[model samples]
Target: MADTRPALPPLRDVIARHGLAASKALGQNFLLDEQLLDRIAAIPGPLRDAPAFEVGPGPGGLTRAILRAGAKLVAVERDRRCLPALAELEEAFPGQLRVISGDAMATDAHAEAGDGAHIIANLPYNVGTPLLVGWLSAQWAPLPWWSSLTLMFQMEVAERIVAKAGSDHYGRLAVLSQWRSDAKIAMKVHRSAFTPRPR
Candidate 1:
């Protein structure tokens, strides 16, 4: 049979070549498993030719999966160590992947990814809530600039974001996060899935 997978280096190989260690300071972890990445990519709905943005795409693990799903992805990486690896992904996929080296929290998502792009990210615990809050608070009249957000968070944090109204868990954060968009748990990842499992 002909080799059918996209011609991209394995995540481990890319990490080693680039010395891409998971930095606790930068809130970095690499999920080397592509199967889970693909599943996460699917939660954004049909992305064939659609615009998508990813935050902190270390070594482009989930970035590859998102490109394979046919979404045009723009990924913002804070750690410059991973930029070369992402550059490889950009070359492999051509127009499908764009790397922005900066803080994701500061990105103008719509301006960077065109109007109304979907965001899918396995965010750092520190960045997840605040990024969502920023996006939620964004001023786009008539409708929000982002079409949807599919994010990964610790189970407890996810609960807080989706907490039901009138329930004890509900709070201002939950209301603000879900007010403009309908959020849900797209998938649960195994704790061991991350390169350096969080304690």
Candidate 2:
């Protein structure tokens, strides 16, 4: 059967119409590469019956990929400017996509995700470290609710996360991340891929 839904607008057009640009203070960077988005979305373990939680889903690039991969998505976007763009994604995916407009830091992501959830995100560089720490920290009376996390950070940060105790990149992040959950650097995104290059 042929699909009858409307096609998505070009990413550039969506950005222009919504006045969405990279914000330095917000650590904004738009990842327009569809292939990369798909790779990021695929990082979470098998989707089968699990839900996917995405943090800082600017412009819904990764959000769309998650839906395309067949997992239900809950996108936590802090920037209000990108809400309209994310709304378009929700419409495209129908009931599969849920957009939460608020700071991901302030929200209890694990509680919001409920049980049997997996997290995947290309997090903002500025706040990525803290967010990861918060996720690993013991929360509530028992522990975190999610089963696993597949997230993107800068190359340096990625190394740190996957580093072993004797490795140069190993540090507090490695210790904490190892203690709570199994983690590793799934991939490395090139600087040219992002809309606004941050070196």
| Candidate 2 lDDT, 100-183, residue by residue in tens | 889888877767777768888888878899988887884633556787888878888888887898999899999988888777
Per-prediction TM-score to the true structure, in the order listed:
0.94, 0.90
Least accurate 10 contiguous residues by lDDT in model 1? 135-144
Q: What tens-digit string does per-residue lDDT give for candidate 1 at 130-191?
A: 88888888874656787888988888888988899998779977898777778677778988
Model 1 steric clash pairs: none
Question: Candidate 2 has what TM-score?
Answer: 0.90
User: Considering every candidate listed, which one attains the maximal TM-score?
Assistant: 1
Off by over 4 Å in 2: 1-6, 140-144
Candidate 1 positional error at 142, Å: 4.1
